[model samples]
Target: MLWAGTAKADYRDSIAVLRIGLVETHVAATDPIKLEAIEHAFSGALGIPVEIIKLGSYAALIDAHASGRVGYAIHSARSFAATEAACGCVRAFRSPVAADGSTGFRSVLVARDSVTLPVAELKVGYSSEASISGWQIPHQAMRAGSLDLPKLVRAGSVGSVIELYQAGEIDGFFGWLPDVPGDAGSDPERLFGGWNRAAIETADPVRIIWSSQRIPYGPHAANRSLPDDLVEALGAFLDQMAVSAPGLLDIFEPVYGGGYVTPDPEEYHNIRGLVEALSDRKSAARIP
Candidate 1:
């Protein structure tokens, strides 16, 4: 946990020793299992333990990385945005696959199967405004599809939206991801069905329609506080792990690709557009 160095280092070695931030998992470098597997993959190559650091929420984790307490963050979409924009201490790593891998998350519009109606005929209830899938992606889809959601679906908290959906309070529910909102993965807690199920699962009978294109995946950003040379060295280390410890990589699933790539915002062009347009909409609504 403190520092893992089984042997002395040589200048010729491509790996640079460093620790992984907590919240990854509790496991020893000699043996990293399941989701915690990433901890030691970095450890073995870097020739160090990569202390595991844990945080409370996405916001807390971003704060830690931005402050330079951690070298990098494998994080969700918006929090990553807030971190880069605020501290400039972090940069994203290019990923091979999106979080959910490739196709990414999709937006789902739900309605009671008991009713046969056009999207315009039903009042739609959407998840939390703070969420990308709940509010952001749906909003974008509405605009792009030339549908006026504000006039049809009511925007509210996620729980409220679900309640409305079941109550017949709203004719339909607008949810991102039939999977997750933009650049996010499934929350087994928030999502239900078989272990293999995806997106908007529920105890109630609700029919859904595709509302938007697939959402993008996100990256774990490196700390800008590190020296450029060290960053480059770390990247090399990750590249090696892709092949050397692919089994470990497999456990992380959808999170890590073959190896680290340059984290670019352009990979998430649609997400960026959604954020900008949403910001503008909220700002406009605030105007007197």
Candidate 2:
């Protein structure tokens, strides 16, 4: 919440130590020495005793933060949204910016150039219902735009979707493109991950028919119960590290190693809404 200002030491009176939660599966395989080095670095920066609590799973990490057991956490976008929905007790302060200035990715509907049908008439294939970019984002975008829902097929996996599209079994498929800021057009060269790259490379003469809004990367969030000054201090320390101690960022978040940037408040709110809607739909479908 506090973006700028001198952080006061008043939090020391109420807090003895700060704890950060990380899911074990989320981190790379590393030795205890590296973990200790991270703790030491954070302690030195915060001027307080800092502890890293590695939980067995994301659920545990979410519960720990929701219950105020940990003061901070590195979360995936979905986990952070779930944590926010659980207690509304956390605030995402920073998220990683990719080396190419990409903050996130957009779900895109890519069709073969030969397909001349309207979007509503195209036979679109998605990886699965569980896929965010492949299914949810594009589905949500279509609903939001009041477009007629296309005939959708679940391809079981991204590989299958690509295979189907390449074989002309489907007119198009949903994939993701890197969300570079201020970019009005989609570039095949800027695909987010290998899946999109694979889709583009193997299926030539493709065009983006539709695209969703940017879906930001996950964030490092602080518990709302933490003191305002402490939160501000944490934010400042992280922002400073992006410039001074980028190696530390690599250790903490190797996926997006560029740097940390303050996230827009609404970034995860949209994710939360989508998650909740998906949850509700599943719940309703189960009522027999």
Candidate 3:
């Protein structure tokens, strides 16, 4: 039976029947039967009865997590950050690595030519304030660096941002580059994302002038209220699945097929800060 009840008196006891929560938006593309099979496989691997709970929205999932109604959750980076800010009661044990050997992507300022201008003097095009790579991450990075803010032009879309840069309307545009850790942007094989495509196709040479810290992929996190042993078992199961059970790995995380790895405690620090800042802004806006 699906467990959607309120938090138990002792959250530790709730793990008797492990419940994994995910939002419908995250799994809407997957088949229900496959999800059921995945649940069964997870139960077998972890040696416990596992139920996959699908919430209507992230808000509900966050509330459920905060209340200890859900022991574990599959969260997008933003949602995970919001959850962390809400309760400080969960920890991400494992995060997916991209097939390209990247843990995540970084927001970068790609210029038509080598940029020698001060950040405040350069006109940079961004897709929108809502875009993580195009505006939010890069904007936060600039503020953290104590650099004077650049002249940000809203281009509405990545394509438009590229066009504005090409037309000389903006000196550069905010885009993303794969976060391959040690490997700099020199490796042609590691290139990914829309901006990389623009750099390749455009006749003019484009160079990445600035980049933000790696923004990790969404993580599979567990509520700290659960028993430590349980969390470790779940982490082990996922971490080893790419080799022991490739099919289940594909079913569980189709997009990032490289496998799961233990998350660096600081992996989501920047994102959490960003979420808290945004939350504060909204709260301030709501005040009279």
Best candidate according to TM-score: 2
lDDT of 1 by residue, 74-127 (tens): 666666666665675677664445333343455566666676777667777776
Q: Which 10-residue span in candidate 3 carries the lowest summed lDDT?
A: 186-195
List candidate 2 segments past 4 Å from native: 1-9, 28-30, 142-147, 194-199, 282-288
Task: Please give the lDDT score at residue 156 for candidate 3.
Answer: 97
> Higher TM-score: candidate 1 or 2?
2
Cα lDDT tens digits for candidate 3, 138-216: 8787777744588889999877876776677888777787776677744322324543464445635667767777888
lDDT of 1: 0.58
Better of 1 and 3 by TM-score: 3
Q: Which candidate has the top score in lDDT?
A: 2
Q: How many steric clashes between backbone atoms does each model show?
A: 14, 0, 0
Off by over 4 Å in 1: 1-19, 22-39, 96-103, 108-120, 140-147, 150-171, 177-214, 227-243, 250-263, 269-288
- Once fitted onto the true fold, the runs of candidate 3 whose alpha carbons sit more than 4 angstroms away are 1-14, 28-30, 185-200
TM-score-wise, the better of 2 and 3 is 2
